[model samples]
Target: MEFFNSGLRKNITSVHPAYFIIGGFIGIHNVKYYYIFLSLIYILSVLGNTVVMTVIIVDHSLRTPKYIAVFNLAFVDLFGSSALVPKVLDTFLFDHRYISYNNCLSFLFFCFISLAMQSLNLVALSYDRLMAIIYPLHYHVKVTHRFMLFFISFLWLFVITVTLFAVGFLTRLSFCKSVVINSYFCDHGPLYRLACNDVTPNYAIFVFATGLILWTPLVFILASYCRMCYALLKISTSKERLKAFKTCTAHLSLVAIYYLPIIFVYCFGASIHPNTRILSLSLTHVIPPMLNPIIYVLQTQEIKESVKKMLKFRGRTKIATKN
Candidate 1:
């Protein structure tokens, strides 16, 4: 009777002290191929974001508020990918699947922090564009260098405060016996699902934090676009209106790149299997950073001219050296 009761108890209690992240794409016989592919992505993402930062910092002409926001976005993308990708790479390449209790929470914390920063940076970018398009005369006064610096500082502090609150609630949750996490990384949903106690409070707080960090900036971006639209309608010439709309193409593309994957993951995550979800999430982290510079910053007329000038200067110097 005692042995039977013990078995029953084990069956009833599924919570565990620590969890194992099973990782993604277990069906692949050769994980090395995945490693090589992801490593290329990681390398490209870092290099691309770094180039944007370098261009913005070194070039005096590119020091406008718009490029400054682009620089900040690059930084967020670099940091966020750094936080998640190496660990993912290790899991697949090295087969190191075990994560400690505290590490899991830390990972989850930083993940959300990066997310908060990205959303905040997007808001800054939208505001820059909105002011430039809708209120060109007031743009200088409204988006002064000092004002942008202060806004960025406030965003970092606010996001930290909100993330701290969420992590505090996360710390209080208790895990029982079930230790295997389905996702590749330590995601909030997967982590909270392992808790033995009621997770309603955690879920509620997460919803609140998401509203503040994600939805708020999204609303701001949408409003800015609407204002831009109204301003565009006031233009009498179709050619001028089309020209004005053309300026928005890069920003609009970036917004779509960043948000669409996120919406798909959150809304349809349950319907998709775990492995596919993991791959999709990984792509979200890797692909956007890689494309941001190519799509938005590098393609700009100013940056293109700068690159050409630098190349010409280098070629001239090389010819002089040969002489």
Candidate 2:
């Protein structure tokens, strides 16, 4: 194990994988410039997700299982961005490319686990919306707080176990040649390419795992939305149907943003132009964290009102305390 760790470290530090080439024109300049952009995105994401989480936790009105799921999604995004962005920023700003082998493995594992959790949370949110739209009377009963807690817990455990297995599989391989990862963070696919040993089993396992994490939830979400649309169509009341449609539209938009780039990158292979890789990476990392908060504020009126009320209350409290 010590030898393996030392070898991994040496391999990773030996060469600077021309990641800028992956960015083409945009990445032409020093990587520090790119890190500046990534840092900005990271700061904004932290603020946005923190506010969302705060709103959900503090506002009693926003404690529904549906919103709880949103909170969890925000939490996942928070950590997911943290996992990749800091290292990326360090690399760009400090020219620090040497992530210890253990840290690299840990980073990779955490990222996948967080991503899987985010995907699972989306699945839960979709189901919650479906229940609300199709079976309003039983929605609350069916998706109790206990149920939400249990489901979220289950997702964490399951994804962690699966991610650990994947990481373990990765550790078994040797890296004889190129140690410099092509991308910013320790992405699984690029890392796999650097392995010296035959990786057929690793690739197969990755395919299965990726399908389970990405495709399965997506299929379920699509099915749920279709059923939801059908149910909405049956509702003759214009107001009721309109409300349902609005919710569905917002959720579908979020789903598209979250899933589409992921599918494109994972399914299509990363052999595209370097510019394409950078764009895909930006979409996968930057856009979703930025967009999710916007989607929630737009789709859920209660959140907007809560923000207004909270601000107003703070303003009044400040005046009263001053007097």
Worst 10 residues of 1 by lDDT: 1-10
**Model 2 stretches astray by more than 4 angstroms:** 1-27, 266-271
Q: What would the per-residue lDDT of candidate 2 be over residues 118-142, giving only the tens digit for each residue?
A: 7888898898889888997888899
Model 2: lDDT equals 0.77
lDDT of each: 0.78, 0.77
Give a tens-digit lDDT track for model 1, residues 38-71.
8898888898888778877877988887777788
In model 2, pairs of residues that clash are 22-274
Estimate TM-scores for all models: 0.90, 0.88
